[model samples]
Target: MKIAVPVVDDSLRMAGNAGHTPYFAIFNLNGGMFKTFALEGLRANPKVVVGEDHHDHDEHHTCDHDEGDVEHIKAHDTMAGTIEDCDYLVVKMACKNTAKSMSNVGVKLQKYNGIETSASKVLSELASQFK
Candidate 1:
């Protein structure tokens, strides 16, 4: 199994928001062993400009199609694509819509408390869960 985690940098520090992270640390589980690899972050198509990076923007919308809305959806979709090969996505927090959209694409969402700061530690904990 493979787990995708949003990271702040090459060090693999967990990023609070998946869409805004600079990289994603993908952990591969084989024979109960895990290996870490990184992928460049996902960005929204340049055609859409989002003024602010808001994690809750999807929660406050009211049937309106604003520029940010388009960008938000596109960004999340791109994020989903980045980890589409993985079996799970682990994040500290993600907007409700983003999580739902990810679930639709067959990537299960695993929300971890911020207490664990490193991707390696988080992957260890997740590994224990599966065992």
Candidate 2:
């Protein structure tokens, strides 16, 4: 089975739809140890942004949903895809909406928010439990 976690810079867990990386560590039940990382592509769905009218003076300022925004959306899409392939996702925190999306993909969401922990450490502890 595989477990996934969302983190920023390896430790900091992001809230809401902010930028974050999904750490997917795959485990080998037969060998009873970690096998490899299963997350290569996974991301969130697109967010519908309301742009200002063309007559607005700030129209040249660019809307929040620009090319950069598209890139961010792609990241989330990759995350969702990766989670869909996983058995479960251990998240410190996630947007309420995103959690629902995860659920729709048949990926269980496990929350770990009480104590500070790293993905590797958390995965190790979970692995020990399976033994």
Candidate 3:
């Protein structure tokens, strides 16, 4: 499983969407252990490749179509694809459209109320749900 946590420039979870979502802290989890080694603070790279193959296989999938209709097509596609691959998300707030789009891709949205949540606090809060 994987988790996608957005953050501000400060590395805290991101709060909202804007003209663009600049970056994401993607956690690559194996067995839900939440290992420190799995946390990756990914910066928004415009040309990032995100296809089913990029997530696993090595082939670069192709879309046989034009990209001009979508203004920020690359960025939007990457972000949405990344979110889709994630099983969990730590988000502050987002437009309903973004939320719905994410849901369409099976991303589980975990809305955080504030921006200053500590790592330990996050663990504690999540643990409570299981208890």
| Candidate whose lDDT is highest | 1
Write the residue-wise lDDT of candidate 1 on 17-126 in tens digits: 65455566777766635543344343332222435453422223332344468766776677677677778888776666557568868888887764887887887676
Question: Which residues of candidate 2, in runs, are more than 4 Å off?
Answer: 9-19, 22-78, 127-131
Which lDDT tens digits does candidate 2 get at residues 42-100? Answer: 24322322232212121123224434565655545555665576666765555544565
Is candidate 1 or 2 superior in lDDT?
A: 1
lDDT of 1: 0.64
| Model 3 lowest lDDT segment of ten | 52-61
2 against 3, candidate with superior lDDT: 3
- Sorted by lDDT (best first), the order is 1, 3, 2
TM-score of 3: 0.54
Which residue pairs in candidate 3 have backbone atoms (N, alpha carbon, C) closer than 3 angstroms, thus clashing? 6-14, 7-14
Candidate 3: tens digits of C-alpha lDDT, residues 54-115? 22111222233344636445444556675677776665555444554566777777755543
Q: RMSD, each candidate, Å?
A: 5.6, 10.7, 10.8
lDDT of 2 at 55: 25
Which pairs of residues collide in model 1?
none
Query: How big is the positional error of residue 130 in model 2, measured in Å on the Cα after superposition?
Result: 7.2
For residue 70, model 2's alpha carbon misses the true position, in angstroms, by: 14
